[model samples]
Target chain A: MQRTTMDLWVGLFVVMGVIALMILSLKVGNLNVYNPSQSYVISGNFENIGGLKVRAPVKSAGVVVGRVTDIQFSTQTYDAVVTMSMDSRFLFPKDTFASILTSGLLGEQYIGLAAGGDEAMLKDGDKIMKTNSAMVLEELIGRFLFNKASEDDSL
Target chain B: MLLPRRLVSGIQHIGHRVIEGVWRLGVASRFFILVLLKSGTSLRRFNLVIRELYFTGVLSLIIIVVSGLFVGMVLGLQGYETLQKYGSESAVGTLVALSLVRELGPVVAALLFASRAGSAITAEIGLMKATEQLAAMGMMAVDPIARVVAPRFWSGVISMPFLAAIFSVMGVFGGYLVTVVFIGVDEGSYWSQMQSAVDFRFDIMNGFIKSCYFGVAVTAIAVFEGYDAPPTAEGVSGATTRTVVTSSLVILGLDFILTAFMFRGVS
Candidate 1:
């Protein structure tokens, strides 16, 4: 009986430890499985999203107002459609332009929204007309390097 | 002509021995898997394995937690120092999370498990074999491999992931405590950075996969050595030592291979 009780205590401690650790991870890591209440969906059309995937953050004025919830290709236009969920409180004018921006020199891509001064606020499911797709860094780098090489060759 | 012929024959013999060893290793691995599968179906053994997992994995939580805390603190302090030079101290969260998930958590937990439960398992099986208890079971028509080895393997498998998860969470908390509580990093920024830095699916999957592989390697080496232990007490002790050393090396090697494959293009 003593051994059994000891075993029971040990078992309980292990379970509680695991639970506590999991709670800490969720709290500190800020892993959000449930969507926030004050968010509405906004869509953007892009030619390329680069490495951006679903649930990527959407930043406006350098603050994360929402996240990319879905990415799909439009059948008719063959353009990549990225759906972002933004905070309802941050009203975006209908003329707001969205661009996919890299976070840093080697960082992941995020959707950056530039707010426009139009009086009309963007409603849920509204599409942003102006969109700038992800700038392919390798392409730009290659162009620069090749141009430098050609210039050296000419000289 | 005789000397040259002898040298050629010696080389040919060595080649034949190498092939034979490789063939034996292949057959041994196949037999090992077949035995595990056959014995894994026993309900009693499964229950025992679960019980052992609770003891091995759950009991080691305190050590893992404490070690994780220190590891996180050291990582944060060092990472902060380096990143501060570059004016990117805020990336401490990303660095800690990535390192803990990709490397430290699994390796630390595995090493801890090896030291704590692994030695105990080797000794227990070795003692059983040395005392002729295993032979008694065999004479009584009880398969020792099914009863003993399978349970240990399953227990190791189940416990490793649990331990790794515990290690990861504690490591993160430790990082948070040092960065936010001690260093006065903004709580919001720290958490936000961690959130943005780690994708839950990828990090968790990486940790789980590494732990599972570690589990199998550790248990297999320990049990194999124990079963194949020489008859003397000295042999049992030698097997125990070999188990720890071999398991640690294999775990480290497999970790390198897994990390290379998992992050092939990313880094």
Candidate 2:
């Protein structure tokens, strides 16, 4: 009787722990966001990635269809090489345009994909040809100031 | 001449303490290895580990759950107050879940485990030593390390990750209750924003790994202190206190190093 009770309680404790882990992985952590088994890899090259990071969302029409898997800096071309794991459920054409974009005024940056009218769909390991780099706020302001100075000189 | 002699003595005392500390650390490492080797017996006799699990893991659930809930509630209140200033109150879920999963969950759970279960293990083993029960076992041809120490150590190792997981889950639930149920934050945004932000591999797995490290550190310290106790009432009390203090410091230090390595460029 004593042994069974101990076993029963210990079993219950272990079960609860497992349930908690499941909740963490499913509801809280969103495990389905990037299941490698159900996804395909694609890469994009950009001149300036700014603050874009690995695991950043890749959205199409404001809905996340993929995630940034890896980000590497190409020393030869000075381009940010971004690798994304796109969900197989969502397919984009070969001429899709990929751009780094921010959500709000100062929120996390994500990759936005605008599909092009192409008959062929992109596959795994395909490199996105059309890409736009992140818009750096400081660089834009600097350019605006330089334009103003140039206009004053002209005047 | 007298002042010089006193200074020399001070230097000698400092050297002595450093050597003692180094020697004690070596002994602890040896003890940990011995416990690992003898852990086979604990597994063969599974109920031993289960019994200790009940004592340490199951018993500590109430304190862990209540504290987790309260901590989450406090975080919700504070996070909403700060986030609302930026007119981004909807991101409260993201803030609560991210912080809980990444930093607070494993760290706070380990701290609580150190105080509640770590101290208990030390006191139990220390008391056993005080009562000469360990010596009694040795006379009966039983290895005290295998019989008493290994079971407790393995139990701690097994239980810690679970305890930390439960703590994180409760904390997230508590935050949800506060932010969505009470404060009237949009439930859709609360969950969706959090789902987008919290990644399973990076945030959740890292937190789990952190808790596992804490488990090993806390239990190792607890068992070592208890085994090294002076076999007296004061010694047991002091060992219990040291178990908590040393475990807390180690947990925090290890957390810092692990966070630096794990979250270096991913943020």
lDDT of 2 by residue, B1-267 (tens): 366888999999999999999999999999999999999999999889999999989998999899889888888999999999999999998998889988898999999999999999999999999999999999999999999999999999999999989999899889988999999999999888998888888899999999999999999999999999989999999999999999999999999999999998887
After superposition, the stretches of candidate 1 with alpha carbons farther than 4 Å from their true spots are: A1-3, A13-17, A28-30, A33-56, A60-96, A102-109, A114-129, A133-155, B1-24, B40-42, B45-47, B264-267
Per-residue lDDT of candidate 1, residues B112-209 (tens digit)? 88877787788888899999999999999988888877777777776787787777777877888888789876777676777666655456567768
Best by DockQ: 2
TM-score of chain B of each: 0.88, 0.98
lDDT of 1 by residue, A1-155 (tens): 12555467546755864674465346544456323477888898898888887767788888778878888999989999999888787889999999999876666688999998899999998999999888987988999999999999999
What are the per-model C-alpha RMSD values against the true structure? Answer: 6.3, 2.1
- Assign candidate 1 its CAPRI class: incorrect
Q: How accurate locally is residue A138 in candidate 2, as Cα lDDT from 0 to 100?
A: 99
Docking class of 2: medium
